[model samples]
Target chain A: MHLSPMPSAIVATELSKTYDVKVRDPGIKGALAALARPRYRQVRAVDNVSFSIERGDAVAFLGPNGAGKTTTLKMLTGLLFPTAGKAQVAGYDPWSGGNPFRQRIAFVLGNKQQLLWDLPPEETFRLNRAIYGVSLADYTTRRAELVELLLLGDLIDKPVRQLSLGERMKCELAAALLHQPEVLFLDEPTLGLDLEAQQTIRTFLGEYRRRHGATILLTSHYMADVTALASRVLIINRGRLLYDGELSELVARIAPIKRIELVLSETVSRARLEEYGTVAHYAPPRATLEVPRETATAASTRLLTDLDVADLSIQDPPIEEVIRIAFGETEQDAEEDTVRTDVQRAPP
Target chain B: MTRFTRAMIVLRAFWQLNWLEELQYRGNFVASLLGTIFWLVMAMLTVSLFFRHTPQLGGWGYWDVVVLLGIFNALAGVVETVLRPGIGHLPTDVRSGALDLVLVRPVDAQFYVSFRRLDVWRLADVMLGLAVSGYAFVQTGRAISAWELLAFAVTFAVAIAVVYAIWVTLMSLAFWFVAVENMAALFDAVFEAARYPVSAYPGALRFLFVYLIPIAWTTTIPASALTGRLNPALATWAAAVGVAALGASRVLWRVALKRYTSAGG
Candidate 1:
């Protein structure tokens, strides 16, 4: 199979957002005081964050709560303007309300949807067809295709309020893509979905990207979503871009160690496992060892030969662990490695 | 096809869907019909009560005022059924950031926002109001002339335009004061005065309604045409007012859209 060249789909420079939140204290006294003199506070939701996406690329924006991922998505989708920065989606200034630009993009928020609550998804589809001015032939064909792809058979006729969460999400996706937008911004699209539902949505997203060659920027707390769909990961923390690169590079940058798990034939002492590497977990008949990348093979070989190893396997540390360490949980481990290396290299 | 025909298609789609959706809540039909009747009866009683002490109010008799009240109810129906349900969603949309979906659509955002939804059951008020106005015309024993009918048509259209302008102006403020969640209520508070004819109002209130806030234009000018009391020259002025109202609302909508930094981001 041949690979296609990447094309630029979205760009942003120094994107920033600040909200003027009204501040007031509690109680009747505070209310009276506020009535006399109101106080205002400016909260910086997204501060000078920037990134770009290429066509046909599925990028996952991972961040903790209040990390500005949703804010950045909103600005990129033309839902909100930056407090002070430049941003563009499909060569149109998002804040300008340009028709051509609007026609080229779509947004789906997990918590918020555009479907009319009292009406069936089909009615919304019809309304969208007219609102977007899509041709009847194109609308019918696209609706049929999306229905088949998303498996929205009986769900489309039911009122949106009557659909289940996962079912509604499927309809939301179908409605969003009915116009065939070139750029898709999905915020926590798999949120509130069960495991099977999550897999279904991920599969649909993969197929959608393959078929349309559309640029997708998705944010989700589910790392499985990231690992499955995103070739590239953009990690953000405290409203800053901590890392931006391929998923492998992020894992390598943050976690250079491989974990080796062993199922011992007999109960192995913790000291024996510690001699080979740090014993992350020790239990009867099972032990987990963390070894440096260079010494992974050596440590695994020793565990098999020197210990009562029943079954042994080597794998990268869990991505969740890597993410936690990147957020400063493993600083002591890094410090210990520094001391141990200094001691080893002293006079050997 | 003309722009009007295209707009009609859009409106027809909304109307059909609105009907189907509203049909689910069949109880609301009786509730709304009763609510309209109650308000109509209250308005007639107010006219009757006023006429008990005097035969004419500011030179117009009881039937003329009732005719004006009927026009007021019809315009109110237009507002509650269409404008309020439609444009009233603007403030919440602004607050929750749902307006993003609307702004990105290919159609004109203002036009779509204003006419996208309909409360079909409230349209009963429109028919009932026209019925009351016809009854009052009979009581007045005035032969309806062709010119009066034509003038009434023009002015009633103008009334709709004016009411639409009021809504646009009110909803436009949502952009500036994003926290003002009850902006539609402000329109409702002022629109209450339009239930009475402009002449029944005292000097200060009349002046305020006609000139300052222009709520009186919603019903008084139209009822004037229907009562054969409209000056031919003022009909031209009313048409000009209708054009200016639409133009001003459009300009205000543009300005409001500019200030919308959106809600979430």
Candidate 2:
């Protein structure tokens, strides 16, 4: 992973969290037995994982469910204390919350709202100004800028409960940024938004980053969100950091092949396409092939030269598929290695 | 600026914003005011029923209990206007992880959580309660001295402190027992006892009220001062209890917060 020389906005070392999970059985006898003495099992929610985020970098955190993505964000934002190790945000220890530190950071939870329920989003915006002590001049400037960019003309005046989910999320984002925070911790900011709203928010965040150069550590299940907004990615699985590097680099390393589709002027024989590459899909006048990255050029040339191919395109497989392949191999390795998923560092 | 001044600033901001939000719903003001007045009338009728049977309650005249009842209403007003709308949200915040917003602010979480919201109409309870107390005071035909008035003022401040402390202690328990979201109901149940003087209850119940839960300090002592029945030593004791309650609640809050497992954490 490439990191700028700027001082780190976030530093987490050996961070871990464990919970005492209630264990119950699935029968009347088990329930009666549990009533006599309730049982609990120690479940490690986050293992000893370490990483540093450089200032002004937008990094995506990706993981399957219960993979500790939210737990790590919680510890870094001072909402939860790690059972062990240390974390710092903007040079201030997050667990030891002080106004100066908190004032410099902004966190947005996708489903949760910071806006007043009965009041309009504008009220929440002003409340944030007061809480952060943002000056009147600065608040006005920031509010106008956010309103314009977010297209929040009458939206801010409408009560939060009356707004649509996409509108509410836009207001939530505006509420978060009114203080001009230096760092942002986003947890699935585009969780349930439609495709258009998702693109709008992704574009807005990209602009915000470019404008303020704020350090962003975003965790999202949406591949488009991560791909469009974050240049680097961190993948965690089962409370462990499995991969940390550029998104493209991880994809190249794990899924080293591309898919090619051809539109032929006439029907092409399956045998003819098989001679060039693995025919993944075949139809009367079109075909798709999976070719090795190094051999894709040769295969495309062979197809164009021999066949009446009218049009052709080459594309990488969906990022989700790439990640799935990478995760599958790791899980298999982990199962063989005694199911040890809590490795301290991700394998390069 | 000092932390206290900073809190004052934040409180001012919250108040201004809330007031504006409330302005949008003008009918809420009238509706809540009528509701409070109706409740006050019912309360007075209930007291009259008690007086109809006995000439006095626990050796105190009818008007004396009215004074106590007035003080009770006033304290309840403070809870409604400030403490309830502010710290009353703590349990839900803890459960929903909304406290994350409060915890991240640069301000003192305890102070911010306690004064961030206000039910503007509830302040009317304070005025009406004081009006009733003054009317009952005049009915006693006792010329209250300047010293007694000073004592009343001090004891009233202590009453607010005690009530605030009780709220803090109750809400802080959300950290440990997140599912008990209705802990404020426990406070309301116990506070019902404060509507009458501590001496009016049976011996065991009186002892429990005055010493165990200390509801006596919240309303009984302040009313006692207005009625010119306050023991100087007890007034001093009330002040001490108020300070102690505040200190204890602050300590308990810190300890309870250590158990906070934020949402998705």
Candidate 3:
């Protein structure tokens, strides 16, 4: 793989974004204070973050609320100009790339919609075809393919507001992908979707990436989406990149414990279950234990021999738990970090 | 193809969609027509009352003022048909961050936002206004020359430009004051002054309308062209003012767009 380096589809170097949020206290005093002499607070949304995504790679950005995931995505999509640092998507400066750059990339925000509320989804699809300058033949072909892949039948012809949330999101995806962009920046694409819809989208996205060899960077709260689609994960907290590596590597480093479950013919006490490892659950004939990865096999063998075990299984803990611990470790430390304003610039 | 032509193609698609959506609400056409007729009657009644009180207003006959009124209605028709529904949504879009969708497209954001919609029903107001102008011109018994007709065409286009420039400037203010949800109302209040001729106003107001706000150029100059009161020099000056207004508005739009932080960040 190192013999030929894959071209970078998206790159950011020391990207930073800060907003001058207006400050005001509570009640009439604050209103009067804002009128008398307005005050502003410098809030750093994304601080000196840098990462790059190679062509044909699916990457996931994970962060808590207000963690600069959206702010960074906006900068890369050319919707916001960075206060400091630089970024290039599809080999063009996102802020100044103009039509050439926009044509090569697509952005989909889950909560916000681009479709016309009063009109049918097909109308928006046609509008995008014109906006992206796609030919009639190509547009027809691509729209049909997306419709089939996403299982959107007559839903595209109905008004957007009339459709359910899941149906609307499916149409939203089709609308964004009409141009067949090489790079996709999806922000919470599966947010607020039902399990069935989420799974549909995840599967479609995986197939779409495989078919087009497109580069995708997504942010999702659902670990299932991350596990199903992304090959790499980037953990961001407090406007900084904490970890960027393979998902498996992150699991190995953050959570080095394996979970063991036992189905015994006889009921077991909590103390007996704890004798093997940390007792996760103890309910009659069924109990769960969290044991160190190095001793998980031995602990499972001992539990099987010592107790009247009927069935047993060992597996790594859920990715959500691992990520929760990752975020917890940095929650307090970020508060103590000093605010750096040396490179702050006026809003563009 | 050039970017402008491609943008036009996209705009055509949006307008087609708008037309289709408008077709779903056919009752609105009847309502809009009735509203236009009612306003026309009220406007003419107001002018009739003024005519009874005086032979001429500011040294012009009743029909001349009616011609200007007709021109005013025609321009208002353009606003309702195109500018109002299109650029009028800017403040709300900016506040709600809906403008993000427009910004991401390959087309020009200002151009797309300015002409993305058309109220087809209000287009009836345009034909009605023009019909009223023709009837009044016949009543004046003035045979229009080719030169005057040509000047009217230029000045009329200049009128639309001036009005559109006003809209762009007003809507651009949303980038700074995101909370001012209906900045278009301020424009409507100011545009009400363009109904009567600038000559009918006192010296201070005449100067304000002519030099400061420039609403006088919207209806007065174009009506003056049809009335044979416009000189070649004045028509050229009106054209120059139209271009300057457009240039200034475009510059303001660029500056203001940079300040769009996009809500829900």
Candidate 4:
């Protein structure tokens, strides 16, 4: 059997996932009833998410919790079978691609760990090297490069459990990259990390992409991660893809207004602050105003001259807020057409 | 290279890592040895207690029953050393979504999960069990021939295959029933009956052990080979049983894996 080749690094068509979550009423009575006859509720975790990512591009998957970001990544990595639709990574059907397909891709989940807990991270690296069939010479060279880039001196030798959270995460990234996969699927790679640690990861990822030219599809809750590493963004909510475009375009479309902060030497009236622009917040010595993006610079300049402002700062709305607006507005427009069948169930 | 060779490469790497990790817990080796000795002595004492009342059990002499017990212990050692720490962790992995890591690897997921871990210290149980079998064979005053020794070797391997198949079947149930976290416990409870010859049990229990659970084939046939009780036809049947058991369990494992939803993303 022969087939046409896919040129894109990753392509997904009408990809979807639905989970048959077991449902039971609360309390002891429901428990007994469930044991006698089980009930199942279907939840559509990912709905018709279709997008193609070109090689050598860093794209961020932005969404709130349970917005199908992780689910999409799982399907792309061939971890979860899609309920409907198809996906291809590195020109092969990811679900049925077998070992050759697996060899060409890597996936990293920040919440879960793949390293052996009792052994050092170095041991896991060796295990992966052997499993992936990397030659000993290439393994040594790659190991040294990753260790230096991730700043993982002596950390790989220590037991995984003994390392700090940040240190362990670095080791995890190194392990996942040992084979230098052509495609990367990262879910919340910097979740729960400190500012410094997050920054380190962001920088390393950017450098790795530049050097390897691998296709990267990353999902992160931290806006800093997206702003630093991704040039494009895809927003999903309620199991649907709402927006997919340039990161800058998404920010411009969702949030046309920029935020300007003012610190007055003395108290200021709410009405006076309103004269400059739309007052977002008003207090004794601090106030914030929302101005049109085009007039942000002029407005901030005028605010400093018009008021007894000790300091003033102009900044665009946070990416989190922009994506939140995108989710809320798009959700309302599509809400009438979609049916809700999902109910919350504790993970098994 | 063939898939088998790739699997071997993965296994060697994993075993090396397991050895290194196990070295750190040397204390567990001592504790495990003590535990094995305690259980062995208790089993021997129980056998002695039964022999006091009767000269033979189920028409077999006392030393023959001891030979069966030794075979049973050796099979249990295989479970503890490999299957217990390896496939036994399947339920937990399924519940926690750790199986995702195993599935993403290029190697076969079933092979990776089945032989991922080894309890090195528990291997002593296997040697000790073989030692007991040899000692009891000597006491039985049986003149062993080359044919009997070869039969014993083949049947012993068959015994291990049957036991491994049993474990895979039990553990595969985890994918269907994620909440049943202690499926291995059920195996342990039933495996306790394999300590004695199936003939020593009543008709119903003997049938259950022989056909349904197949614990009888795991120990009895191998021990019978050494004790001069196994016929060539019966040994051939045991090999067939082993092959069939492995084939059935493999099919079950494939079906169960389809049901894996990969919990917690």
TM-score of the second chain in each model? 0.95, 0.97, 0.97, 0.98
lDDT of 1 by residue, A1-348 (tens): 655364368878888887665556899998888678766556567878878887789999988677688888878877666889988777678877477788899888898888889889999888777666678999999999899889889899998999889988999899999889999889999989887778888999999999989889999877778888999998875466878889887766666788898898987788867899888888868888888989999888877778777899987665446666666646575477546433432110
Candidate 1 docks at the CAPRI level of: acceptable
Q: Write the per-residue lDDT of candidate 4 for residues A1-348, one digit (tens) a residue.
A: 544364889999999998877788899999998888878777889999999988889999987788889999989988889999998898889889999999999999898899999989999999999889999999999999899888899999899999888888899999999999999988888988887778888899999999999899999766668889998988887688988889788766666777888889977899988887888878768888888888999888887777788988887665545766655555454465344463443345
lDDT, residue A181, candidate 2: 87
The candidate scoring highest on TM-score is: 4
> In candidate 2, what are the lDDT values of residues A223-338, reduced to their tens digit?
77888999899988767887888988876776577778989997778987788888878986878898887898888888888888899998765544466667665546546543
What residue pairs are clashing in model 3? none
Task: For candidate 3, write residues B1-265 as lDDT tens digits.
Answer: 8877887798789789889989999999999899998998899899899999899887778888888888889999999999988888898898888898789888899988888889988999998888888888888889999999999999999999999998888888889887654667777888888888888899999999988889999999998987889999999999999999999999999999988899988
Clashing pairs in 4: none
Task: State each model's CA lDDT, in order.
Answer: 0.83, 0.85, 0.87, 0.87
Record all residue pairs in model 2 with backbone atoms less than 3 Å apart, i.e. clashing: A99-B106
- TM-scores for candidates 1 onward, in order: 0.83, 0.86, 0.89, 0.90
Per-residue error for A44 in candidate 2, Å, reads 1.3
TM-score, candidate 4, is 0.90
Worst 10-residue lDDT window for candidate 1 chain A reads A339-348
In what order do the candidates fall by DockQ, top score first? Answer: 3, 4, 2, 1
lDDT of 3 by residue, A49-162 (tens): 999899999999987777799999999999999999999898899999998999999999898898888988999998899889999999999999999999999999889989
Specify the highest-DockQ model's number: 3
- Of the two candidates 1 and 2, the one with more favorable lDDT, higher being better, is 2
For model 2 the TM-score comes to 0.86
The CAPRI category of model 3 is medium
